[model samples]
Target: MTLDFFSPVSDLVLAHNELLSPQALGKKIKIHSEKKGFPELGDVSIVVFGVLENRNDVNYIGEVFQLNEIRKIFYSLFPGSWNTVIADLGDIKAGETVEDTYFALKTTVCELVKQNIIPVIIGGSQDLTYAMYRAYDTLQSMVNLVSVDAKFDLGDSSKPMKNNSFVGKIILDEPYNLFNYATVGYQTYFNSQEEKDLMDNLYFESYRLGEISNNVTLVEPVMRDANVVSVDLNVVQGSEVSLKQKFSPNGLNGKEICAVARYAGISNKVSSFGVFEYKPSKDDEMTSMLVSQILWYFIEGVNCRINDEDFSDDRSYQKFITLVEDQELVFYKSNMTGRWWIEIPFLSNVNNKLKRHTLLPCMHQDYIDACENKVPERWYKAFQKNSI
Candidate 1:
């Protein structure tokens, strides 16, 4: 069956207006609709799908998800320097039960990933990230998840699932495939001390909003290491996304959030990406345009992807070795992009799933810090995770 999950986009919104202009993105991209029908995605690189399920969103109960408003702005924008074929897969309607919706989403994502197609998810709630994570269950590898959010959302796993608490469910659920989880632009006041402590105890990473706002590039390495990246619009300040689920006065501004999205798209390992917690309002032009630009940057990044996985080609990279506190550290700098990576030595005779990830994305500052006898925290955490 064709999943029987997705509904046609042409049926969901008003008749195509500016979306059908010759130079508009809507005219250039394939749409899953009643007239033109579902996309024949053999050459498609990115598929955008909107989820209409939001029963699990604690902040906005029974609020209708208006993804079409987002689409109006997104599809009307002019294309960038992208050559990757893109498709708008339309919306996945809410099922009778939230679990049913999750199943449909998981099935859809799993299939897309299997076909090597990157899914750009516009979600009804951030809890949809749980379903996105479950889509990787069959891959048989440790999953690295990076979320752009203001709060930790580490609610009690014992209770019912909601957007605010889905991360706890992901952590406590079975199968045990999650390897690393990182939160970018997190505000300290929004998260409980216990949740903050939990992140530390697990050796997971967390970057404060102020820290990232001061240095946006700090998220690049984290995004590069991620296999799945989810953005909660609530991470953006109220001024940027005024209609977001939970508006905050202090958070990442428009440009910063878009940069984070672009980083996720540029990551060769990231196969699935989502933007959630958006609630459309009448005066939603700015929010919709912002979301559209974020999507644009992601596509732009995908178009400019660099293949730097292999280091055997001496002409492509420079290798550096430094001694810190009697420990030998090895790093590689990509001549093509100037990106740095540090080698995490695998233990002999160890049967670790992460043994294949010997080299991890890092910043040049980490190398400088290692030279100053300060071991980077990112390296230490990866080393510990690999030891486990």
Candidate 2:
């Protein structure tokens, strides 16, 4: 059988070393390396993305990527690998069996993540998320999902081969609770009212374009607990953009895209990330540059999350307004063996919409114990500092 998946693709980068790039958000570069492959869990990762097939725009006539630049990005992290492990998940033809592709992606992601290395998946289809979720949860046990896309990916489950529905498969199957689910930039036309109702019942936090545009501060709390983040490039609208099913018109821009990516990386809970739907089929140099910028933002955000211990903000009139609006942050506490969360909304220095809003470890047993029994310990007094 002639396979349409493994089309030859090009890659690039030069001698490995820790060097900064021109548009990088993070000033520093570091990598955790294997003896002859990608870095493991604790090590910082430097993955250079390339299309699985050569479709000119998709892989650029087998000249999909620059090897020298890839090497430069990797080496800039200063990791020493005898040989690099480059994973290409195949072209993913339109009619290809989903099961076959899913398994391949699942196994590959598990392998990379098992080594504790951050596996950054860059490719075309959103179906990649299904395999990613299965892999991370199966191998790592517990994980929370975050999606940054223009649609909820909740199409009909009856049609197995459709563009959307992987997410539907996951949620309807209850493979994981939809409680941790959060999405941004949803289009009304792209999603149905029935689907929205289902998501509400499932407890997924989502914001349409209008809501987020009116107030972006809503994203931080929704993502504070997320572990795996996925982004769809279609959320951006521009002439240079590309995709198999393009619909970026009247959407966010490249800088806003980087802002979200940066937020994901800065999330202390997020461990793995995927950027999908970046089909170079209609892409221009500007699109490539935008993608590159998003990557840099990811690195920079991670750096900021890991290093910045203090979570303070500038106190100003604008900040006060933001704080006032955010004071309605939600709070959730589990009383019955952690099976269910009791959600309550209240105002605070943090953003409201309550239910474990702050990721600052503020929902610990000690806090619960102190508040539940009205028994205040001097030690508990100091625990508030850590928000535990």
| Residue 170 miss distance in model 2 (angstroms) | 0.9
lDDT of 1 by residue, 77-106 (tens): 888878889998888989999999999989
> Could you tell me the TM-score of candidate 1?
0.96
TM-score of every candidate: 0.96, 0.62
How far in Å is the alpha carbon of 230 misplaced in model 1?
0.4
Worst 10 residues of 1 by lDDT: 10-19
Give residue 292's error in model 2 in angstroms: 1.1
Give candidates' CA RMSD values in order: 1.6, 11.4
lDDT of 1: 0.88
Model 2 over residues 1-388: C-alpha lDDT tens digits?
Answer: 1223333222222123324553232123322222223323233343333323212122233333322333243333322221223232223332244466666656656765666555566655666777678876565444567788888887777665334666787676645533356778787788889888877665566778777666564565445567778887788875536443356576666767788887776666666787776654433445556666676677666656543223233221011011122232222332321211112323356433324433322223334454444322222222232232
